[model samples]
Target: MSDIEIIKAKRAGFCFGVKRAVNITFKAAKKGKGVFTLGPLIHNPQVIEKLCKEGVCPTENTEDRNIQTLIIRTHGIPLELYQTFLKKDFKVIDATCPFVKKAQQYAKLLCDEGYQVIILGDEKHPEVKSLMSYAGKDAIILDSNQELQKIKNKKRVGVVVQTTQPTNLLQEFIGKLVSRVSELKVFNTICNSTALRLKETKEIARRVDLMIVAGGKNSANTTQLATLCNASSVKTYHIETSSEIKKEWIKDVARVGITAGASTPEWIISEIESRIRDIGGNGDNGYPHESGRN
Candidate 1:
């Protein structure tokens, strides 16, 4: 009998915002003949595929005349894009996450108040781009690891973060900026779900011999979990689905842990857990170390 044990993070998979967006899209699909999302509703490809089967599809641009209904992505679209879509004949459904919407509002507020806005996140991420649009042309985007460059003569500075940023990263950056600007206004825009998932994943990584991080490779939060696991010096594999799990990775491992990103679905996590059992896990014992949180 295999002695290997498997544990799953209680906080893993399908954060509130993702669930809300998916549910709204599915509901919309049931009510209409032609429903389209401005982009993939979330970062998970498997979820997107399922939506496609339901007659819900993603359109990169709003140029199609055949588009009858348009749903905003969870990450949200730029202010101008959203405004332009409203002028079209198609019905518009906004499924943007409330947290992301809050960040956008704060960015716009800061800009209008004459504070030079600084956003903390990957510059290329859709969420960050949306925040930048609200912050106006002079706003700056900074990565967590990017060095803080000295500002020339800005007096008041305002900071807003992507909803998925690490809490510690925001704190660290804010500390550095306080001394540089005469007035510093900071909004802790990081979502509580993202913070808790990272904390739980790190704890699981420290206790397990190997970690299986499940989510789309393109998902920012999913990749962040893998990066955190690797930094903890544990063997980690970031997979989109159960099929990506390799037999060799679990060989000789006494304990394996499973964690998923905000966009990951419960079914994907369950499938991965079952795959681990078929490979080398000793069954469901210690499988779900429930923390009473989803």
Candidate 2:
């Protein structure tokens, strides 16, 4: 009998927003050629490759006059960049996630209300950059662990969080802001899907002998999942594809838990699971259990 048991997260694959963006891209591809996304539709390389095969490609700039249909990525683009695209002759298909769109709206509203806007997330991230555009020139980007002295002199502060940020960060950031600013307003822009995935992944990490997190390295949500797994004190491997799985990692492991990011596809997760089983001898494999979907 095989010693390894495999457990899978029920909600381990593509989240609603990602699924929507990908569907829209494929449908656009079928309609004609010269389809391009402002950036990657989603972070997963495999999915992007498939989209390319279907004639939909990703472009970083709008300078390419040949682009017939420009689809906005799931992360959305900066306000000025979006406006520039609208004026061009190319058809613009906005596939920005609804949750992200809400965050942008909130950022603009906060600025109009005369509060200092603070966005909680990585300053370099595409989504945060897009949020900053709506928040105006003076808006500040704050990391959860960073000092709040920048906003100390301001009487009023408004906050918006990245859609994939952990809930604890928001709670903690607000706790600190309450005392420093006389009036504080917050828009909880974090996605519900993100919260559920992190919660489920943490629980599984605690129970398993080893954790395997599958998704694109550049994907923020995927990286967060891997980080959470490591913090749980279980041996963890963050891999983009099944080929990354090594035989020795599972040789002696008794229980393996598998989870994926919002950008991951179901097929990739299945391949990873299959690889683990094959390496562990596939004979009398420990029964697999499924947690509820995200």
Candidate 3:
């Protein structure tokens, strides 16, 4: 077999907000006073399972009001839910990413100023739901510009986007909105980490034979990474762990590129690179300690 080269993107794995949220959750678990989180602390299932082992339970039922502490996920919750939790006498820790908080702030601001708040994201996504709550129940969620047809006779529109969405999508959403609303106030809330990941994914994809996007299959950002890479017309695969790397995908491929979503863990990315290396080599049985990136 010809030697296969692997290029890992430098921006792969956990971003600042995810890192900060995970760090805080882990520390909360150490307190041992029945710590729990509103949801899987982040999108990575492996990390969530490990956190469970560390006594950080992910709870959606939340009937255990006696719980000592509750850590909010990286995506902030609605203001009413936060107040409700506080009223229930739980020691709520706001681990919401600062970027998400900023979006929520914009939503509230737009509502206060009487602009029809339109969020550029999936309506069901926690981040978008949180923003809409601040914008009032009637606030619109525009996952794509096509949704705009549902709105008629609107005088003013204000926009805020879920931070994980790609810049192109946001631009597309905004461009379509220009003809729909009389007054437009745009607060582009895409986080720095997301911008970097999207940019780096394309850069690595263009230079490699096959691109591996590592992160939770359920993660929107991870899916977007794969979509962005595929748009470059390179073969792309999205996997949550090393075990998902199929041999056929590597066969006859001389160069491999790897990039991951913001919520992905570095260890998982390393494992994936090792697996790719093993499959490409002739039972060499050894792999690089660290993946190469640019």
Best candidate, lDDT: 2
Whole-model Cα lDDT per candidate? 0.87, 0.88, 0.85
lDDT over C-alpha atoms for residue 123 of model 2: 88
lDDT of 3 at 124: 85
> Residue by residue across 1-294, what tens digits does model 2's lDDT show?
454688899889899989999899999999998999887788899999999999988998778987999999888889998998899989999999999999999999999998889999988888999999999777999987467987744688899999988789989989988988888999999998988998999999999989999999988789999999999999999999999988778766778999999999999999998888777633433434223411
Q: Per-residue lDDT for 105-215 in model 3, tens only?
A: 989999899888888888888888888889865588888877888665378788899887878898888888888778899999988788888888898899998999999
Instruction: Give the TM-score of each candidate.
Output: 0.88, 0.89, 0.86
TM match of model 3 to true structure: 0.86
Model 3 clash tally, residue pairs: 0
Candidate 3 pairs with clashing backbones = none
For model 3, the run of ten residues with the poorest summed lDDT: 285-294
- The 10-residue segment of model 2 with minimum total lDDT is 285-294
**What tens digits encode model 1's per-residue C-alpha lDDT throughout 62-89?**
7888789999988988998889989999
* Cα-based lDDT at residue 268, candidate 2: 95
Q: Which stretches of candidate 1 lie over 4 Å from their true place?
A: 1-4, 144-153, 282-294
Error of 1 at 38 (Å): 1.3
